[model samples]
Target: MGRRILVVDDEPDILELTRLSLVREGYEVETAATGEEALACLRRSRPDLVVLDLMLPDRPGTDVCRVIRTTPELSDVAVIMLTARGDEVDRIVGFELGADDYVTKPFSPRELGLRVKAILRRGVEEKTESEHLKQHGLELDLSRHRCLHRDEEIALTAKEFLLLAALMRRPGRVLTRERLLEEVWGEGIAVTLRTVDTHMKRLREKLGPAGDLIDTVRGVGYRFRE
Candidate 1:
């Protein structure tokens, strides 16, 4: 089967439009009209990705995203938030809640499809790289897509896992925000540089004291401690 996608939106037009667009791109598409329905669908079966709207009738989309990130079985599912609100704060909050990407309302379905393709492609590419990275009490099993701290499992969203892997793979190398964006989110994705800062902040917080290993090089960018 093609990559499965669940598109959650209250608007019938928007929901069908998104489903049709993704289907045209060869994804098996499902639709949900409320946060409750979306969560129900999620619990029933896992999709490869979710196109979640920031606003929902029963609950906020962030709540659904929070559930996905906290649920071990769903944490790795890639999510692209759809929002009428273009505020950076909303985007940052979505990222903090573990969304992989966001598309502002009035978005082009083609661009959304591209974002989906880029994210899924990145995942497939990473899985092909079987190397494991261990350092500073953190271990990344690239093949298994797992992160561990001192042999204890550390839950991370897909972006967080990939972002840390990028830094850990090149310890001590100062990776500028632009470069990190390319490596993590891929080229031509419409996320801002602040998105990097937000994800890094969340990554560090999740790492606890080990977060210190990711050193911010002031304005230049960030590097993993050597």
Candidate 2:
């Protein structure tokens, strides 16, 4: 009941629907029809989470997300990418731009609402108090679909994030490429080794100076610093 969410989209219909869902969940909601408006609104008041449409009227949704991720003022805000685009590359782009989660278009409102709530809850945790080696300097609130590093928040695409989380959980232990693919991309799904490499490159770049956090084991797989 205390949460506030900002929804940015060019579509009036979807905006209205998303607003209705969040409002029903007992949270304050703000809607923007353009990326410029969303940026302006966010500048005035920080929201608990952001539902960002991949397509926008002014700049590309990826650009908007980049701005949010790079800004110190809005660093902690959790962002969920909402767009009609479902391509793997698009998802990686969203993550590289610092998105906490990715949800394709025509997604269920009920499911979205649950995800929104979870993301919000995850954003507020204190990572130092957490038990696991847990990727220090980085705090991942899975409920909120957001990640924070060195007290500065970092956005990750859904898959990159999943991969990061999976590796982090096993800190110091090497996870084979096949195992990572299975855990992050889903078992029985046919994928390429290049796909894994590409996502890893993107993830490392966004991690900035901390890119070495994920280590390539060579002839084996990858390992996260314990």
TM-score for each candidate, following the candidate numbering = 0.56, 0.54
- Pairs in clash, predicted candidate 2: 95-157, 98-155, 118-143, 119-143, 119-144
Candidate 1 has its poorest 10 consecutive residues by lDDT at 86-95
Whole-structure CA lDDT of model 1:
0.89
Task: Kindly list the per-residue Cα lDDT of model 2 for residues 139-203, writing each as its tens digit.
Answer: 67766667778878888999988988888888899999899999998999999967888999999
C-alpha lDDT of all candidate models, in order: 0.89, 0.83
lDDT of 1 by residue, 84-173 (tens): 766864554455787888888899999999999998887677667789899978999988989999998888999999999999999999
In the predicted model 1, the residue pairs found to clash are: none
Q: Model 1, which residues run further than 4 Å from truth?
A: 89-95, 132-226
Q: Could you say which candidate leads in lDDT? A: 1
Model 2 reaches what TM-score against the true structure?
A: 0.54
